[model samples]
Target: MLDSNETIVAIASPTTPAMRGIVRMSGQSVVPILEAVGIKSSQAKRAQVIQSRIDLGTPLGKLDIAVSLWPTSQSYTGQPSAELHTIGSAPVLQSIVNVLTTAGARAARPGEFTMRAFLAGRLDLPQAEAVLGVIEAEQRGSLEHALNQLAGNLSRPLEQMRSEMLDLLADVEAGLDFVDEDIEFISDEALVERLSVIHAAVDKTRQSMESRGGNRSRAIVAFRGNPNAGKSHLINALVGREVAIVADVAGTTRDVVSVETTLDGHAVQWVDTAGIESRAQHDPLFEITAASQAHALRASQNADVRIWCVDACHDDLAAQRRYFETHDGSSKRSSIDIWVATKSDLIDSTQRQPDWMYTSVITGDGVDRLRDRVSQFVASHDKEEVGSIMGTAARCSGSLAHAATCIETAIRFVQQGDGHEFVASELRVAVECLGEVTGAVYTDDILDRVFGRFCIGK
Candidate 1:
């Protein structure tokens, strides 16, 4: 379906200094450009040659180039395509693209190249989405998932389901047309069975689409305790950076400090909140504002894990216990509350605290153990993958929901002993809902929204 009217060109490389850069061009003009640049070759076939300088007579100077060409049928967009590999200098790359544009090629729009591939039937919507996934992926797990989708892992199952739905629809239409026929083309029992299979398949896909990795979960980890509890020091130690302001004075951390980091391939947001206190009058007016402090307290209460960072050198152990005892008890059980004693270097070698580790954020003592415990908590709560299922997009999810409603109506019609025609009408509506998911009967708006998320040069 590629339009023959326009030619597209783009710099198919990251906008950073690298060893090599490529300027890709596709359409009818590619062959003429290759021939003009002294890289003489047949326009009927694809060819590539290294270090072949294409001298373009321009105002700047004669241009030196390397060229490769793919014939119309074999090219990515089903049009004549070429790639000019040059030194990794931005100026050289820009000069070549400028020369091509002057000769007659418009700069490719964002995602236009990939969009052409989709229109040309080279890729389906899911595979097209995977192209973007491969580009933006940062983790190994995410990269594997994207690669699997690109290889048509999800598409095969979706296509099977679509085929089943189409077969059922065709049977229903045939039954309606031959109303007087005695032959049972599609029995009531068979119709119910087909609908059940379709519903089950769609439901499975919906479940798979739910969040998988630890980073997708909204759980947070908060550091809390009395003033000078080494909260700031612990934050820096965990992230291996000096992100929070560390000071010897108490109440130094009056505001919440947060940072995002990955732990065991799971994304986590670490928060350091102001120390909780009993005396309200002594606190500053800004701290007293219910909205601000309440927000922090709520976050702490809802956190997946709350580390009560305590100072090991302090002698008032019982007082600290009493202080936390007076506060609300609901949060204590819900959150994984662990007592952490910082500055283990200052404590006596013989003395030990019960159910507590000797942690020195400064010396990096027992920090690895702490990180291991956090990783364990995340892994235990993550969902397991059983049967293979496709991750549903927002549009697919909405379509499934609509189809479910239509199926419910069909079920009611069957139970009420409505005429076969009425029951068939509701089933047709159900089939349409399913069709929308696979782009069989999609609106223009749906198509635009799906493809619009892609990058221009894709």
Candidate 2:
């Protein structure tokens, strides 16, 4: 929207003292700008690299640079584009940018390059956000999620859903237009089924977005169970250090102990909570046990994943069941529930529970398996929710929720024998809502919110 016909330029590479740097330019005047800056061979460009020198004079006389050109209109921005590769000297790059600006190119705004790509249909709204995700990704998991979004993992399905909705809307409107013909465009059962599918899809997407809103920054794994169940030792083993104090005494960990580390390319916080036990209210230590229990329950409630540690040698199946039943209502349940039989080395293989992971910090029996299960659970939390649109999830959640509501309403109308006109109207609203997700119905404000976070020269 910002004068696409005019040329824009920026230094594409990091402003560091390195062996190479890049100045990127795009628009109709890319070739002319190069020619004006003394690159004569740019005029004959057809997606070729041209070697040239710029006569800066004075402090820096002539410097050699290579210019890679996409002279045709099939480039990243769907316009003529080029990049000047040279030494990664900040001053030198700034000077080259200044020279290009003086030769008829304007300095690019933040996220302007990707914004242009979005405007030119090279990338959708979700994909544009993924570009930023890739830029700001701190770990490999985040990067992979962003890369998948950029590759249309989120957009493709929404696009397909939109297409199907459009077909349904057309049929509804057609039925309304020919009401007197007594023709059935879609059966009530079929319409309800289709609408339900759309509603389910939209709801799933909305829930996924909500899940990301709470834990997008990192995953919380809480270690909890009866005192002296080896919870502290397990935490230390997983973190590869003694982050939590371990002891044979029950209730030794009277507070929440947490440590941050990377597991399977994801930022994970390991939380060790106090052992769960009951003390008489009249006991002098009642208040202490009560406070520790409260903290443990709070940590368990807040955790994204929970690992229940049971003493393999002492706790029987009945005790494990009672432990779970007593603490089930303590907090909001974790998305993943893991049972761990700790101190496995103290017992034989026949003592292991089939459904519980067995581990022993003394011998390191099932620590790696438990760690893998936690990592896999965290990674696949919302994978099916439109390919886990990591970065765009929060942004599009409202629209997706609204779309689901609209579909639900339309389905009710169809079931209640409402006129086709009403059904068509609701479907129209749902279609527009989906369009907003993919930039097919975006406003300038949405564009600003999406592209504003991008760095210049993307």
Candidate 3:
């Protein structure tokens, strides 16, 4: 558990010198801190503002500041919070923070204020993450998504579903407790009906997370293939720099690494992900390898364009033909897939697939053609709507996907005339999964992952 009893202080505005900067404070001691700085406690009441000066003594003299106060526990952190706005000089801000700390305030940790708001029930998990998203957003579309999420556009439905599931679970468990009595707490048909609805809602949310591409302002071009297919070299060649590590060994890239550049006037982010390999998660030897494969798969799915890099010297053309014939580029209508024969310098023209693009980073062959193809794809979809999901939504996707599966299993149990206890167990897991999405249920690890990325003073 986190302690919220101590007074915390931080510089809330940008550190760059400007006309004004704000040093924010939260906790029961905020009023006392103001008094120590020479501002009257009474003057710093809720919604009240005071023009004041803090005497730093010696060379710095007294600095003019504006104080905005919420003397009661109803501020952003659900505590008595105040903001001291003064000239945005770096030294002045530091001096003010020093004054507050000496008086009674401790410097706040990164995202501590927002985390306190979450712990106090002022904002749910999704809303708290959205606050960070708003702070870090670089493009207009990302900002819009973050704002909408902050407004409860996504959490509202999930919260509603969780509530309904709780009611259904109560009914199902009640039926088990009264098996000897002549009362039907819940009908089998009703149980299935409610679970079906929950399943549908989970599936809808999952699809949105999966379909949302990264950063609409720039196109995501992902390189994917089996191990040692020259993906790293190709990305280096395209960017004209050594962004990804190149090696002759398999599985050199275990995580997704990307570089941003302009391709024929179109902004693009080229991603080099781990090689797609067969590995069993249950095996201790392949556990980490399997994780890397999963990361690669997710990157490819979110990409706007997948560049399939096939090793020209080693891969069998017949198998490649079969794979491409059956698989579509992507489920997303806007996404495209282009096959490329990599390391073309090592193979003869007769050995390469006629329809596929050929490229060799060593000899600089066909790199420009590959660039032009990706640029064309980006231009065609320039006007398409982007920003399908907030980045934070990625976390909820797994939870919601699991909830959907659990609900489906519960539905099956009900239909098959399984014991009420078995049905209740499935519903319990399903409810917990939904709870994780909205933060009705959470662990310390979840909190750390969500808030650790925030900049201090947010």
Candidate 4:
């Protein structure tokens, strides 16, 4: 539990200059400091209320400040808290913090305020972590999911699971302890059934977490093909800027160039790699070394989507198609490949249009359709709902995987008719692993690692 006596202060607003800013303080001493700063409390029948200007006399003159005082047990951190709204000027804000410090309030450390709330039982471990998630969220889907978790959506289910596990553990312990008395609290069949149900529920929760649509939707898409495929032109058209150098000369782009864009509201890192071909070694930077080829292959293998651009004006579209058809057999199943026929404006009037898209970056012809196709591919292919899944954090993933392993071992033990105590021990380990996810058991190092990412005011 946090000590109410140690008051802390921090600037609550962003560091950037703005029209207004706020400095917040919380602890038992906050009310007294507010009073000293010219805020007077008055008794009205049964309750006390502050009814004066929040700003006290300044060295130069009276400053315009808005202050709200929250008394003990009625504040966010479960302590007396005060919020001082002042001008956004950096100097003015710094002065306010200095004054607060001089008045005995110490500067708050990173995440100290939120950590205090957790210790005071105002918010649990998962909800507190959600605060950081909400702050760092880069997309709307992630923000919504994090807000849902912060509102106790995630914690409610975990609490129910924990309670169920505790009840089962109690039954097993009672059965083991009073075996000689023949109490028969839990039969072997009944124990196995309960364990099976618990395992299934945990597995379902893990799957749900993995399928949620949020952070996982963020992916990198790389454009790769043979020489003079108009990859640079396509990238520039997508981002609506001169993000990459485009030239009619083959192999103009010898390195990877990238731009950030949102496709159908999903964040994407679009990269244009050097054209792949059999070329002689020349300039070290431009040379297609074995390492460079391996790197390109690795990027293609790892990309969420690969757009294979074929220059319709020169290259044989059918040949490019055949190459990809053969390559698809050896490619990773996770990659989504698309065929793009570039420089379509130069196609002959009698030439037949292939099944692939025809795009001309110069005239912006078919660009919209290309973008639509890309969006459609992402929507149809990467349909996993990341927000409902469990493995957003490495720690959560490790815990759930560990729990699954433990449960699997325990099931084997039960099937082999092993000692009941051994089965119980494995089940206990599984429960402990789940407990780590909700921070039911945590060390100082764990706490530091979790909260260290937060800003000082949060």
After superposition, candidate 2 runs with Cα above 4 Å error: 42-45, 216-391
Error of 4 at 116 (Å): 1.2
> How many pairs of residues in model 3 come into backbone collision?
0
Candidate 3: list runs displaced more than 4 Å.
43-45, 213-390
Error of 3 at 189 (Å): 0.7
Candidate 4 global lDDT: 0.72
What are the per-residue Cα lDDT tens digits for candidate 1 across 91-132?
777777777787778888666676667666787766766776
lDDT per residue for candidate 4 within 313-341, as digits (tens), equals 75567876787666534554446677888
Top TM-score hit: 2
lDDT per model vs. reference: 0.68, 0.84, 0.82, 0.72
RMSD of each: 15.7, 14.3, 16.0, 15.4
TM, every model? 0.60, 0.67, 0.63, 0.61
Worst 10 residues of 1 by lDDT: 381-390
Task: Return the top candidate by lDDT.
Answer: 2
Error of 3 at 349 (Å): 44
Evaluate candidate 2 by giving its C-alpha RMSD to the native, one decimal.
Answer: 14.3
lDDT for 225 in candidate 2 is: 86
Q: In candidate 1, how many Å is residue 103 off? A: 2.1
Question: Which has the better TM-score: candidate 2, or candidate 3?
Answer: 2
Of candidate 4, the 10-residue stretch with the lowest lDDT total is 43-52
**Cα miss at 60, model 3 (Å)?**
1.4
What's the TM for model 2?
Answer: 0.67
